[model samples]
Target chain A: MELVELLKTVELFEGLTQAQLQRLAEISEPARYDKDTVIFEQGQQGDRLYIVGSGEVVVRVGEDPRSARTQVYLGRGQIFGEMALLDGGPRSATTVCSRNGTQVYGVSREAFTNLCKSDTAIGYVVMRNMAHDLSFKLRHHNLTLV
Target chain B: MIYKVSYVVSGGRHPGAIMNEYERPQLGDRVEIGDKVFEVTEVLEMTPPRGDFQYLHVTVRLVDENENP
Candidate 1:
C-alpha cells in the first residue's frame, strides 16, 4: 500500500485529510526488524511511535523481560508507543518483532509535535482518536481481569 | 483482499490481536495467537469491506493445552 494510504488507515490518523496524511508520510521513517528483535524494552523512554507496515510485532507487559506472556500482536496499520509520545512517560510495555522481515513506519514525537503546532487539526483529531484507543484497551483489560 | 482479523479470546487468559491475513478465519479452526493457541468459535463482521481492507471480530476459545502440546 502507498505510504500515505497506510497512514490513513492508522487509528490515530483516522479522521485526517489526504493532505494531512501526506504531511505525516513526509515525516515517517521506514524501519525493518528481524524475528525475535526487541523493538523496545518496557520502562525505556520512547521518542517515536511505530506503525506496523508489514509482518507482525508483539507487546509484552510484565516484570520479567523474558516473560512468555504477550499482551497484543500488532499487524499492518497498528500503532505502538503512541502513549509515550503523548504522555512523555517510559514505555509501559516491551515490543518485539515476532515475524521475520517485520516493517514499520516511525514517526518521531518531536516532528509530530511540530506538525501539530503548525496544523492544529492534525493534533485535535489524533488526540481524540488516541483517547478512543486508550478507552478500548482499558475496557479490554478490565474485562480480562474479570 | 487483506482481512484485518481481531481475534478476541472468549473466557481465555491470552489477549487477542488485530492482524492482516490473506485467508479468512473459520469457526473451529485452532490458531496460535499471542503465545497460546485458540479455537475460533464465532466470527462477526464489525465493518464491511472498505477498499482492500476488511475488518472481522473473531471470538476464540482456548484449546486444551495438553491436546495442542
Candidate 2:
C-alpha cells in the first residue's frame, strides 16, 4: 500500500488527513535489507526514524552495550527505534535483521524536521502518536507496579 | 537546533545505512548526482562523535520516510 494509505491504517496516524499523509510520504523514502545485517548499533548516533515495510527486525534495549537484551520483533508497517530521532539522544535500541531478510522505510531527522517546519501540525500529530504509544505501553507495564 | 537527513542511491557509495541521528546534512544529503534523490527525513541536534573526524553516522531504512509506493 502507499505510504499515505499505510498511515491511515496505523492507529498513531489514524486522524491525519490524506494531504498530510501525502506530504509526509513525499518527504520520506524507501529501502531494503538483507539477512543478519546490522541496521543500527547501540551508542551509534542516529537521525532518521524507520518503518518496517517487510520482514522482521529485533529491538535490542539496555545500557549495558554488551549484555543488552532484545525486547521484541517488529513486523511490516510497524515502526521501531524512532524515539531517538524525536528525542535527540543516542539510539535507544539496536535494530538487526531478525529473519533471513528485512526491509524498511526511513525518514531522516532533517527531512522530518523540514516537513514539520513547513507543517507543524504533522509534527505534532506524529509526536503525539509516538507519545501515546509510549504512554500506553508504559501504563500496561505499570500494572506490575501496583 | 540541529538537523539530519537520509538518502537513497540506486547505485552509489554509502547507500544502505539508515540515518537515525546526525548534526545536519549538507546539500549532498538532499540532492543526488544522478538517478537518485537523497531526501532528508528529519532534523536533530549535532552530537559530538566519539573518535575521529568522522564523528557521527546517519540512519535510514530500506523504505523511504515518505514511502507511498
Candidate 3:
C-alpha cells in the first residue's frame, strides 16, 4: 500500500487529512530488515519511528540475548520507536525483525518536528493521537498490576 | 485502588511494582514501559514443583499506538 494509505491506517495519524498524510509520506523513507536482524538495540539513541509495511518485528528487553525476553511482536500496520522519537531519549528496548523480508516506512524526528512546526494543525492532531495511544498503553499496564 | 504485583521478564525478576486497578489486564492488553508500548499477547500462570509460590507470566508484543490492523 502507498505511504499515505499506510499512514491513514496508523492510529497516530488518525484524523489527519489526505494532504497531511501526503506531506508525511514525502518525508518518509522505505526500510527493510532481514530475518533475525536487530533493528535497534536497547539504550541506543533514537531519532526515528517506524511503521510496519509487511512481516513481523519483535520487541525485546534484557541485556543478554541468551536471556532476552520478548516484550511484544509487531505485524503489518504497527508502529514503533515513537517514544524515543518524541522524547529524544535512548531506546528502552531492542527490536528485531522476526520474519524475513520485513518491510517498514520510517520517519526521522527532524522531518517530523519540522512538519509539526510548519503545520500546527497537523501537529496538534498527530500529538493528540499519540497522547491517546500512550494513555491507552498506560492504562493497560496499570491493569496488569491489578 | 492500587494492586500489588510482580514484574517478571524472561524468567528473571524485576522489583515488584504496583498499578491502578481500573481496567483489569487481560490477554491483548497494551502496556507502556519506559519508551515502548507492548501488547499483552500471552499470560501464563505457573506453580513451582515444591514451592508455595505461584507465578504469572505475561507475554506482551510491541505495537504501534496508532495501528488499527
Candidate 4:
C-alpha cells in the first residue's frame, strides 16, 4: 500500500489532508526487519517513530530484556515509538519484529519537526489526535489497575 | 480478507486498536496485551470495511490467573 494510504488508517494521523499525508510520506523511510529483530530497546534514546507497513511488531517492557513482558502487538497501519518522537525521551519499551519481513515506515524527530514548523496545520492535527489517544490510554490503564 | 481489530479487554479499552494477524480472531480465542492474556468473548464491527481493510472491536476478559502465559 502507498504510505499516504496507510497513514490514513492510523488514528494519530487522522484528519490530515491528502497533501499533508503526502508530505509525511515523502519524509518517511520504510524499513524492513526480520522476525525477532529488536527494533528499539527500552531506555534507549530514540528520535524516530515507526508506522508498521506489514507483518507484526511487539512492544514489551521490563527492567531487563529477558524478563520483559509483551505489552502490545502492532500490525499494519499502527504507530509505535511515537512518544519519543514527540518528547525526545528514551524509549519506554522494547519493540521487536514479531514476524518475518515486517516493515515499518520511520520518520525522525528532526524531519517531523521540520515539517511541523513548515506547516503548523500538520502539527496541530497530529498533536491533537495524539493527545486524544494518550488520554484514552491513560484512562484505560488507570482503570485496569483498579 | 484483511481484518484489523481494536481490542477492549477486561472491561477497559486498550490504549490503541491493535490487530492484523493473517487469521481473524474468533470468539474463544486468546489475545495478549501488556502482560495480560484475554479470552475473546464478543466481536462487533467497529466500522465498515475501507477498501480492503475491515475494522472490528473485540471484547475479551483476562483468563483465569492460572491460565496466564
- Model 1 chain A poorest 10 in a row by lDDT: A136-145
* Model number with the top DockQ: 1
- Sorted on TM-score, best first, the list reads 1, 4, 3, 2
Between the candidate structures 1 and 4, which one is better when assessed by TM-score?
A: 1
Question: Between prediction 3 and prediction 4, which has the larger TM-score?
Answer: 4
Leading candidate by TM-score: 1
Residue A125, candidate 2: alpha-carbon lDDT: 79
Error (Å) of candidate 2 at residue A16 is 1.1
Alpha carbon lDDT of residue A66, candidate 2?
A: 79
| Candidate 4 chain B weakest ten by summed lDDT | B12-21
Q: In candidate 2, residue A4 scores what lDDT?
A: 77
- Please list the residue runs of candidate 1 whose C-alpha ends up more than 4 Å from where it truly belongs after superposition: A143-146, B1-5, B20-39, B44-56, B62-69
Better lDDT candidate (2, 3): 3
lDDT of each model, Cα atoms only?
0.80, 0.57, 0.66, 0.76
TM-score of chain A of 2: 0.84
Q: Find the candidate with the highest lDDT and give its number.
A: 1
Ranking by DockQ: 1, 4, 3, 2
Task: Write the residue-wise lDDT of candidate 1 on A33-102 in tens digits.
Answer: 9988998988999999998988889888886975657787787777889889988999989999988898
Q: Give me the TM-scores for chain A across all models, comma-separated.
A: 0.91, 0.84, 0.91, 0.90
- Quote the lDDT for B38 in model 2: 49
If both were scored by DockQ, which would come out higher, candidate 2 or candidate 4? 4
lDDT of 4: 0.76
Which 10 consecutive residues of model 4 chain A have the lowest summed lDDT? A136-145
Clashing pairs in model 4, backbone N/Cα/C closer than 3 A: A71-B34
